[model samples]
Target: MTVKRHDGRKADEIRPMTAKVGVVPNADGSAMFSFGKTVAIAAVYGPRHLHPQFMQNPSTGILRVNYDLLSFSVAERKKPGPSRRSKEISKVTEWALAPAVNLEEFPNTVVDVEIYILQADASTRVAGINAAAMALAHAGIPMKTLVSAVAAGKLDKELIVDVDKEEEDFREGEGATDFPAAKLSGRDEFSLLQLDGKIQPELVPKALEMISSACEKVYEVQKKALKDFIENPEGGNGK
Candidate 1:
């Protein structure tokens, strides 16, 4: 018998999603994305000068991402300032997004992406990546394509897409398998793939297959947000 999701969604179904662009006026570009209760906002500041000349890469502009989960985002307040996990996820976000951005044109410069979670249920990093990708495009940064990301894995014996905090805390035998991934739009290639927990080796392909479809859904929302913002720079609401 197949197991049922706690939220009554089909194993392959994701929660309600929202996307918006041009939310921060002072920023060169900014956007927000949410997967159910997890909301992430991203601001892009530059393809500007890189200070400390020695650190500049003369051949390519670097992508720097800072991901912060606000102290108030969760029920238990986190300490103010960057934690070890936040720092790690920042790098992960950069790598997940670098493939789609064309940075070589702005050599010796840096594009800084700041992502903050206004609320956290789970899969916050994936939400951040979705927002950051739109923010970069909103900033007028050149790009090969936008990126879309999602978390897919198994809750106990059932395969699922877009795991929530409840699924993340599942502690049955073999527990939860959390797989977060990002992909360039319209491509089968994955730019980011991170795994937590366990899954059968044979099931890897199935999970990837599931994630690809999920990313497509994400890409559509991102494209719409960008298009709406362009048509009306009045700042579109999350759709």
Candidate 2:
């Protein structure tokens, strides 16, 4: 039998999400976001001096974002050292957030964004991106647009959005033949593919459609949260 999500959410439904800004006292700006069971915290530091001097771009400030996955958050015990997975995630987070930030305004300076995964149900990368974006805004960093991220996957022969661990397991077996197992294979369509299974090339359009819609819904939550923080700066609690 196929495992269903708790809310009976459709395949395209993104988990309920909330964003709060300025959660840290020491960082210049910070934000925390919860998407279903996955939680991520991001802190923005910088425009600070660079080391060795040579690393500085000279024309524009650098945007550095660190993403850490806490061992306690996941079910399995994780090794302390950084993983190739984390490195890949860090690169993607930086790319997704850099375009939104106006680095040119602070030439020779650097803005560092840190993302910590407090909980990992699923979709941690998307959560990290959301948290980082909120933290940057709370820090008063100028941005062109708010970046959004989400994952789409195939399950039980159907394409789904925001697949949790339970749903994922349903499709992982030799008996799992009926589902859309081969609808889309390569993940080139998505900015980041978190799914372990494959789908066919023809189904790429459908997957993009699902992911985009989910992102817009999430984007609203982020905008509202940042707006609330702006109206009540003290409420932000970011030092």
Candidate 3:
């Protein structure tokens, strides 16, 4: 069965994307990123002193991430405080971004990344991760490379890139699944890989390949956003 996306994109195509840096003046670095209707804003603070109690490694900086979904971010209003799912997402996001950052350079300090989802469709975490990466770069944090992420899944027996909310519903349930993957730009190593729902073991490799190519495209958009912000800090469009 042939499956067509409502947005008119090809199976391998990603959604329309836009990103901008320096969204929050008070934050050391900030970015607003959107993939179609899903929007996420990320703020980076610190590389500053960490309290004595929380300092786990005296020789390396600590990276912390907080992921939040606004009460009105979805069709049904979400709760105000962090839920268990949010906490897990925060942990994975932190890990996903840590590989790109030079944490050892600022020992006894912390780099805090906060990501807020103002709107959601699907692939919200991926959007948030991409935003957080841009925010870190904006803050002048040393890094190996920026991170880019994308979600791909099997829908109606066909592989699709950047799943939207409707496709994610998977009501028909024909081997549907959500595979979210993230990797450092220009690198083959994966920083995050998550699978939800069912997919044949044989297809896993193909799914990873699709997602990797999608991330490379996302990486180009991320680079453009950072470049634009650096060249036009005062006239940035993120606000």
Candidate 4:
């Protein structure tokens, strides 16, 4: 099986990433991210009130994430209903972002992180995760670790990084399962893991390795955005 490559990039190459903070005024803080053809936005709201019954811990603040895909993000228009996929993503997002926030200070309040995918090519979840981290940091949310996500897939027996939609289809086929592939499967190492096709256990480690490298690159972008936000309270461009 022959695999197509993007711009001759290496198997672990991440797309050009950019993060911008304070894009939304309504929210306490916000960030936008561009990962190749993928686009994601994240907004943070409140250490505000939470229903008494829903409170998980009165000693710490709550972390919640809401994820949504725009109707026009893909070829098909998505319905305006909650999807299990989004729920799963939200859960992982909350986990990945939780570590960064010092929830103990807020007690009964809750912080909400909202993620919207405007465009998706591949690695939308990872992009969304990264965006959420940036938004929280922009909001001055105290966190321990800066989390990020990315994916690796096998195409025609070749393990490639940042698999786009076309490559994803090829990787999902019956024969694709036999090839080596990897994914981010931990909240500590990665924010989320979702796989539609098959992957060998050995490949899982490789995927984590690639994801670690990618996350560092993304973290740099996040730091830059947060730094700019602080330096130029007016605008990143200093307008």
lDDT of each: 0.92, 0.74, 0.90, 0.72
Candidate with top lDDT is 1
Candidate 3 positional error at 126, Å: 0.3
* Top TM-score model: 1
* Candidate 4 lDDT by residue in tens digits, 50-157: 766567577998988998898889888988666998887788777766755798988888888999999988678778887888788777777776666666666655
- Tens-place lDDT digits, model 3, residues 1-239: 55677778898989899989988988999998999999999999989877765665788999999998999999999989999999999999998999999989888889999999999998999999999999999999999999999999888678888998988887675756888889999899899999888788888999989988999999999999899987888877433
Clashes of 1: 0
The segments of candidate 1 whose C-alpha lies over 4 angstroms from its true place after superposition are 235-239
TM-score of predicted structure 3? 0.96
Write candidate 2's Cα lDDT for 23-108 as tens digits: 99788889899878999999998878876588898899999878879989889977766799888788877877776778887888
Give lDDT tens digits, candidate 1, residues 191-212.
8899999899899899999999
Q: After superposing candidate 3, which stretches have Cα over 4 Å from the reference?
A: 173-175, 237-239
Q: Lowest summed lDDT over 10 consecutive residues: which window, candidate 2? A: 176-185
Cα deviation of 114 in candidate 4 (Å)?
0.6
Name the better of 2 and 3 by TM-score.
3
Supply the TM-score for candidate 2. 0.86
